[model samples]
Target: MPELPEVETTLRGIKPHVAGQCLRGAVVRVQKLRWPVPPNLSELVAGQTVDDITRRGKYLLLHLTGQTLMLHLGMSGSLRIVPDEIPVGKHDHVDLLLDGKRLRLTDPRKFGAVLLLDHDPYASPLLAGLGVEPLSAELTGDGLRSRARGRFVAIKNFIMDQKVVVGVGNIYASEALFRSGINPLRACNSLDSKEWNRLVGDIRHVLTEAIAAGGTTLQDFTGSDGRPGYFRQELRVYGREGEPCSRCGAAIVQEKIGQRSSFFCPDCQK
Candidate 1:
């Protein structure tokens, strides 16, 4: 799935081209996705200018004249800007028509979403229920610690909870925890102020670097420009299960936490 960095990368990649551009219309090749593409999507978006583009968690928001378009690139989806004359691929499911170009959405797995919102997106149930953005000012050590109180969940699962913090997916969670020198299996409330602070900083650092590198492309992720993310090459312990830890020479280990594969340096990450 496209995590925060990948979603942010897509937002940045397509915003420049789509913002302020009038949408001629939308073409929904298939109406069924993770959620059904709005039936009247073409009519709703037609002739409306995209006033702005932003991201909340892994969802992309295209602020139109009076409505908002919310998109979720599910398991294996990508957006691309291409000329109108370009031939659409089999997986190209939707297209937002522009003057002479189009913003195309390709979802091989058909798990992406295109929803038309007539009201405020941030006020909607979808965006309203989301946790604080991990990159925002609200994400501090103290705030996290407060939410973590009384939680016996593993640290990895605690951070991965969408209600506690948004956009920290499995891969980045492992990377951040590894950088924080905290074992993923540790209970969430076991951390002190200093450890919480360190973990918060490392989380921000890992996400910032991943965004700069265009996100981790372990399988199907790519920016709107159709470029694969390069951060996978820089992964510390996410996938190198039995490999030597980069910092401590001890073998990096993998285990199932919250039913998700988690990798950590057993020696370096205490």
Candidate 2:
């Protein structure tokens, strides 16, 4: 699935073209997605000017004059900015026809979503329960420490919780924990102030680096321009199981925790 960086990259890539452009029309080639594309979605956005584009967690928000269009690029979804004359591919589920450009949504697995938000999208159910954005000022070491006070869940799982902190996906989580020298299986409540400080910094560092690299392309993720992310080339421990640890020369290991693969250097992390 496209995580925060991928979604943010998409928002940045498409914003220049879509923002301030009036929508000529909306083409819903297929209405059924992870959630049904709003029945009147086409009418709602037609002729409306796109004011801006932003991302919250993994969802992209297209801010229009009176409403916002919420998009979730599920496990196999991607948005591309293509010429209006370009032909749609097999998985091109929707398209927003701008004055001279086109924004197309391609979801091979149909797990993505296109919804209309008449009111404040942030307060909507889809976004209401999400936790602090890792990039925001509210996500400090003290904040993370307070949230983990009495939780017995694995520290990895604790940070991955959307209600605790948004956008810390499996790959980024592993990288952050590795950078912080925290074992992924450590109980959340066991982290002291020192560890929490390191963890907070590592999480921010990992995510900021990933966004700068245009996100990690391990699978279907790509920027809005259809470019594969280069961050995977800079990975330290996420997918280097059994390889030498970059920091300590120890062997990196992999394990399944909470049904997600976790990579760490035993000697370097605890």
Candidate 3:
């Protein structure tokens, strides 16, 4: 699945091309997705201009004339800007037509979503209960510590909770915990103020660096320009199970925490 960094990269990549453009309508090649593509999507967006674009968690919000279009690039989805004459590929599912150009959505698994919202997007159920953005000022060491108090869940699972903190995916959580020298299996309440401070800082650092690198491309993720992310090159220990730990030369360990694969250096992360 495309994580926060990948979504952020896609937002930055496509904003320039789609933002401020007049949306003539859409061409729905397929109406079936994670949620059915609104049957009247084209009519809902017809003649409207895209005022701006923004991201909340993993969803992209295109602010239009009287409504908002929310897009989610599910497990294996991507967007690309191409000319109207370009031939559609097998996975090309939807196209939002602009002036001589279109923004194409390609989802091989059909788990992505294209929804039209007539009211405030923030209040929608899809985004209403979402947690704070990890990159925002709202995320603080004290805030996280407060949330973790008296929680016996694994620390990794706690941070991965969408209601606690948004966009901290499996890969990022693993990498951030390893960098902070915190074991993923530790109970959430086991962390003190000092540990919370370190974890918060490292999470921000890891996510910011990943966004700068255009996101980590482990499989089907790519930027709006159809370019693969290069952050995988700088990974410390996300998928390198049994690999040597860069900090202490000990073997990196992989375990199932909350049923998700977690990678950490047993020696470095205590």
The per-prediction CA RMSD against the true structure, in angstroms, equals 1.1, 1.3, 1.1
Model 2 spans > 4 angstroms off: none
- Clashing pairs for model 1 are none
Decreasing lDDT order of the candidates: 3, 1, 2
Better of 2 and 3 by TM-score: 3
lDDT string, candidate 2, 233-252, tens digits: 88899889989999999999
Model 3: ten consecutive residues of lowest lDDT = 37-46
Model 3 agreement with the true structure over 116-159: per-residue lDDT tens digits: 98889999999999998999999998999998888899999999
Which portions of model 3 show Cα errors greater than 4 Å? none
Candidate 2 Cα RMSD (Å): 1.3
Error of 2 at 153 (Å): 0.9
Please identify model 1 stretches exceeding 4 Å from their true place.
none
How well does each candidate superpose onto the true structure, as a TM-score? Answer: 0.97, 0.96, 0.97
| Clashes, model 3 | 0
Tens digit of per-residue lDDT, candidate 1, span 139-159 = 999999999999899999999
